[model samples]
Every structure is written in structure tokens, then in C-alpha cells.
Target: MLEDLAFPIERLGQAVTDVQLLFEKYKYENGIIFGHAKDGNLHFVISQGFFTKEDIDRFEHFNQDLFDLVLNKYDGALKAEHSTGRAVSAFVEKEWGPAAYRVMKRLKNVIDPANLLNPGIIITEDKQAHVHDLKVMPVVEEEVDKCIECGYCEQSCPSRDLTLTPRRRIVIRRAIKRMEDTGDRAGRKALLKDYRYDGMETGAVDGMCGELPGEH
Candidate 1:
């Protein structure tokens, strides 16, 4: 689980300590916390598994605890540094209160009344939408699993314009692996038709990705 959070500068010291302690309570000792204190902005990343009901329940409880602390204790922003997509859309009202949320809905109605622009993203009626589509990252292969899909290698790939970049190659590979695992033969065949050219034939295959920094 990763989140970008913000709090008042005065509470920076306490907030950081509290968050670390909260993770410890959850037994997530590997939780990483980092960001800038100048803006009281912190970004934390923690590895978690949702493969079991116990894992899901634990995450839900931890999420509630963190949100209560941020919203009630410190009055902080749940989404401080990134797009308030479906992940935080359900909490918009909790963060801004009902009155401001209503104004936002009215403004959205005036602007995109048709609801064609990124619907169920910034504002959503489904409270559990975020939990519904939890992504399970299957290990495709040891070499490709390490890619975070950050797209940093795309700019440097020699065949980026001609074919799939390093990131896209790995993405398609993973998708194909998922489809195969799920027995989606038709979908796999359709994707493989394009994958032959975009993912395989046009590659320079010069180990440029390996030379780039980090696991990717």
C-alpha cells in the first residue's frame, strides 16, 4: 500500500512518528516512509498481500486507522500529491465535508454534465469501488517481474518509436501471461497477433534496459 499524505508543518514530527508506529502495530516493519518536510508531504510505500481474507481484513482495519488519524487527529489530506482517482474518490466527502462535496458535485454537473470525462474517478457513488478492483501482480518471470513500469527506459530505447518500448514489452508479456494463466485463449490469441510485431519483431534487443538504473 502506498499513499501520498499531507499534514500541517507543526505536526510534521509527531505525524511521521505516529505513522511509523502505526505501521509497526500492523506488523509492517518493512514499511518505507519518505518525502519532504518542507511541505509536510510524505509518501509511504508498503508491500502487502491480499490473497486471503485475513490479509484483506487487516488492510481494511489499517486503512481505517490511518484515515482516522489523518482526518480527525491531524486534519490532513488523504490525497496530498497525486490525482484523486477512484482510490480516494470515496473519501472526498469525508475530507471536505458534505457541503463542499455537494458544491463540487454541482460544479461537475455544470461542466461535464454527461459524465463522460473520467466518470467514477474523482467523485464516485460506490463506496467500495476502490476495494473491488484490487490488482494482484502475478510473477511473470524473474527478469520482467522487477520492472515497476515506471517508463524511465522508454525515452532511451532505440526502437521506442518503431515498436514497443522496454516498459510496453514487459507489460504485454505480463498481460499475455495473465491471460494464459486464466485460460483466456481467445484474448491471448488476439493480443499475440499484435504482440508478434509490436513486442517481438521490432525490438532492438540490445540490453539497453539492463544498463538503465534500478531493477528495470
Candidate 2:
């Protein structure tokens, strides 16, 4: 899980240290920490797995601890680079205070009465909604599993306009792997049938995606 934490500009060093310590407490020793220090925005990516009930409980506790540390202790923001999506929706009220949060709720109700505009995303009543509907990253192959799904490879790929770009190709492969794991043979076969044309024929096998600076 990658979260951009925001704190007072002067407290960047302390905030980073606290976050690193927190990661260690949660047994996430290999957590990747980086970001815009000038703006006091620290982006930390921790490898989290929600495969079992124990994993989910651990994540919930870790997230609650993280929120408490950032919001209560440091007076920081959980979402600095992105909107308060489902990941941090339940904390919007705690972060903004009751009055401001009520105003935001009223504004949302007035603007979107039917609750159609990304309902349960920015402001949700379900406290555990963030943990629900979690994406399961299937281990397809060593190279494919390592992809972060960043679209940097799409721009330089020769097959960008022809068919599926490099990113989409990885996405389809991942989907296929999931289908196979779940015994969805029909779906896997169908996707593989199309992949031969869109992913192979139209794909540029010239190592163009690799020539870029980063991994493909």
C-alpha cells in the first residue's frame, strides 16, 4: 500500500523517522520511503498482503496505527498527493474535524442527492470499506509479477496505437493468470485466443520497452 503522508514542512525529518519506525513495528522492514521533502509529503510503499483473515486484521491494525500517528500525533494528512479515496475515506471526518466534515457531507448531499458521484469513495459510512474489495495480486511470472502497473512503458512502446500497449499486455497476462488460478478455463482460453493477435502480432518484440530507462 502506497500512501502519501503530509506533515508540517519543518517536521519532515521527524515525520519520516516516525513513519520508518512505525513500519518496523508492523514488521514491514523493506518498506520503500520517498517523496517531496520540501512539501513535507512522504510517500511510503509497504508490501501488504490480504490473503487471509490474519493478514486482513494485521492490515486493519496497521492502518489504524498509521492514521493515529499521522493525524493525532503529527497533525498530518493521509492523502497528500491524491484524493481521499476508499483507502482513507473513513478518516476524512477525523482529519477535517466534525464541523468541517458535516459541511462537506451536506455539500456532497446537496450536489449529488442520489449519491451517484463516486459514492462511498471520498466520504463513506463504512469504516472497514477500505479493506473490502481489496485487489489480489496474482503471481503470474517473475518478470510480470514485478510490474507496478505504471504506464511509463506505454508511451515508448511501438504497439501503442496498433493494439494493446506494454502495460495492457501485462494487465491481460495478469488477468489470465488469475483466471487460471480460479479454474476459469473458458475465460482464460478466450483471453489467450485474443492475446495471440493483439498481444503478440501487434506487439513490438524489438526490446523497445526495455530500452527505456526503467524496467518494462
Candidate 3:
């Protein structure tokens, strides 16, 4: 989820200043993109099935195009607010180029030659680290997957100031679903009973709207 890159406002496109228009042009159609455009920063998620090689290949190809758009065309960062972990570490050298990237590798080797702290996070020579053994999300039988955990819907949430948050609402649902799927009946019951109040009866679960949470 953290692999989504960032770009400059001017670099988003030639004429599009609006983030929504930029999204339309570049098309993060499957993602929910939102951020502090004032700082020329945005966060988005590409909800892809990462179980198979094909899925990894799709992400690799997508990253190729994205790298072309950001680094080659606009000179934007491969990373925004999010750090380049295993997800985008493969492209760090691309962003910094050979000389600078080699300098980065030397610095890493000098400090941590054994690769103890945060290995494969950055300064990696592995060309396929980004796509290797990608984590597969388990299936759940709830509409809660609609929530991207982007925190975009949290700040504006009224219940966040009062009772709960949109993200936490989905989180509770996911936990309950997990308990249910695992046949933890008692756990599921306790969770459902507790959530029946704020989650079910209040604004937290009003699908997290722009209006007052309970209005809908």
C-alpha cells in the first residue's frame, strides 16, 4: 500500500492543477487518492491481487509507466510521505541514478554491512525484490474491503471528534469478520455486542460521508 509515489504539482500534468483531474488523466481508478495538495503530496492505494506472478508482473509494468511519468518526465520522487520499503526499494537507484545510488549503497555498507536494520528497505542490489514473494491479502466476506485504510476519510469524520473514526469502523468490521471466519464465536459475539452501540447505532458507520456522519 505504501508503494504509491509522489509528484510535484506542476509535474502532475501540463495543464491540470486539480488533483482530481490529475487522477483522471493518470487514472488511479482502483485507488482512493487524497492528501495535502498544498504540500504537493498525495497518498493512494492500488488494491491488487498479489498472489500470482501475473499480478506481480502487472505491478511491475505499472511501475515502469509510473517511473517514466515521475522520474523521467517530471523529476518527481519515487517516494512521497511513505518510505521506500520492500515495495519500491527496487526503484530507489532509478530515482537517484547510478552514481548517487552507488554512494547510497556505500553508505549503507559502511554502516550496516550485515543488513540488520530494515533490510531490503533501501540501497538494495536485488532487481526483483519489489515483486518477490508479495504478500497476499486473505479473503474476507464483508464489504469492509471498500475502505482502503488511507486515512483520507478520517480527518473530516465528525465522530472522530466525538465517538470513533471511519477507518476504525472498518477495522472493527474486519476484526469481527476474522473472528467469524476463524469460528471464534465468543470473540465475534463480544465484538459485535460492543460495536452494536457506536459502530452500528452512531455516525461512525454511516459510510463516512462528507456531511455529518449520521445524516445519511
- Please report the candidate that would top TM-score against the real structure: 2
What is the total number of backbone clashes in candidate 3? 0
Q: What count of clashes does model 1 give? A: 0
When summed lDDT is taken over every stretch of 10 residues in candidate 2, the lowest stretch is: 207-216
- Measured by TM-score, how close is model 3 to the native structure? 0.61
What ranges in model 3 sit over 4 Å off? 2-4, 13-28, 143-216
| Alpha-carbon TM-score of each model against the true structure | 0.84, 0.86, 0.61
Using lDDT as the measure, name the better of candidate 1 and candidate 3. 1
lDDT of every predicted structure (CA atoms): 0.80, 0.81, 0.66
Residue pairs that clash (backbone atoms under 3 angstroms), model 1: none
Candidate 1 local lDDT, residue 175 = 81
lDDT by residue (tens digit), candidate 3, 45-109 = 55667767676776777666666667876777777776678867888888888999988988998
Query: How much is 53 displaced in model 2, in angstroms?
Result: 1.1
Error of 3 at 68 (Å): 1.5
TM-score-based ranking, best first? Answer: 2, 1, 3
